[model samples]
Target: MFCSTELAARLEGVDTELIIAGSAAAAARRPGGDGFTIPIAGGVAAFAEEGSPLDKVAGLGFAGVPEPAELDAIEARYAERKTPVQVELAHLADPALAELFTGRGYRLVNFENVLGRTLHDDPATVRPAGIEIRPSDDSEFDLWIDIAAEGFANPDTQGVASHEEFPRDILANAMRDITAAAGVQRFLALRDGETAGCASMRISRGVAQLTGATTRPAHRRHGIQSALLATRLGLAKAAGCDIAVITTQPGSKSQQNAQRSGFDLLYTRAILVKD
Candidate 1:
């Protein structure tokens, strides 16, 4: 007798916890900074570093409208750290929270479409000619990071500016640390035996979240991403994951590729920032 909305909320909460945990682990490895999570009124606030990547308050949800005092305290905490207060609000999140933030000057900065699909039978996909996808090894770690950084730097992608400023060494270190954490896997896509793209999966609570899927500009329109997506789906299923989820910018080629590969839109999440 569980409602679909309730189920979605529960799943989202689990996913958010995994994200916060992984971020905290990665932040712990930072040379001069640390990552931590703070419990707020609705959900947890995850901080990676003062000005580092993905330093934001995310997975925000509330059973009911939160009091203004609670919101104020959250903002004050981030302000004290000299970083912008950011929140990610899923479609199912309390609408009142959005109103409260907007009234307090939080700008709607970005949007991400959450897509998911059940992993049953292995999805059929043809590996593009001269392309191969395989689990990454230590030797290919640096190459994977380089390809990911370049793919995310494309101006056509969301938050390209943030990705552009990411230092390669910092990113490489973070990736190495996070991927080493439990239930995380990285895959490399090679075209003619040369690295062309990368994808990552983090499994938790019977769900696999596919993230960091990127293909170099020169490798686009060649089905590299689609092949990787299919490969990961099969891997997730083989790893005992019941469902797979992915997030991407709305109307982007990434979304189109995911939908074509069997993922359906679940909901859209909005990113609000107070800077």
Candidate 2:
């Protein structure tokens, strides 16, 4: 599919809404959690909590460029809570957005790529022998979080350097809140009857978002991720999603895997931060 401003708007809009929903879930699940969203320029700034992974600005510059005063107010909002402003600006967004951020002392921190593929029929998949993928049961929520946090804590070293890293406890917390969000479905990959990997998908407005997936360090290279991806894609297709999307650190292993599965690079987001 052609990458255009209109396409970017659609993709980013879904992501922004997901963030809002997840933040709201976090607030309801955690003690003293803050679920707040502010409109800045054409984007939405989200704050789930101090140091929460869900905190960031998305879908910026889709409406129109913001004045310096509006940017100042956005910055002030984050500053009030001792949090830095982290904006994920799509490359296809208005060029003036980046210029405004630079002029306002925002520093370019990292880049993440968004890849997508249209979904129609069930995706063809190769399931490694002895591996099984299934929806996680409600009773296994803690187990799911533990596996996800463990995988994240021991991330693969082959990828591009990560833009941001968090402690295992923080990762666990984030996973819990994300799972609490409406429309999110969690899946577990088992190898020889042992849990080896975990993944999640969220469908909104006919867009299936592969929110995240991780394999236990010991389970890496066992095709667990591929199985998880295939299962999610099939589920998304069956759920009537028109398209599916995923975000990954630029040049990272996740990006490599998605490409191997026939997803196309739709856009890259520059993570600009102001502290």
Cα lDDT tens digits for candidate 2, 1-275:
56789988988988887777778877777667446777765668888877788889888888899877877777787888899989999999999888888988899988889999988766878799999999997799888888888887787776666677776666666666666775778999999999999999999889999999999998889899989999999989988998999998877889889989879999999999988
Assess the local accuracy of residue 191 in candidate 1 as a C-alpha lDDT between 0 and 100.
91
Model 2 global lDDT (CA atoms, 0 to 1):
0.85
How much is 31 displaced in model 1, in angstroms? 7.7
Show the colliding residue pairs in model 2: none
lDDT of each: 0.75, 0.85
Using Cα atoms with residue i matched to residue i, what is each candidate's TM-score against the true structure?
0.88, 0.94
Give the winner by lDDT. Answer: 2
lDDT of 1 by residue, 73-182 (tens): 76777777788887778877777777888898989877877888887777786688999999987787878888888887663553312312566766775677567654
Candidate 2 TM-score, true structure as reference: 0.94
Q: How many steric overlaps are in each model, in order?
A: 0, 0
Model 2: C-alpha RMSD to truth?
Answer: 1.6
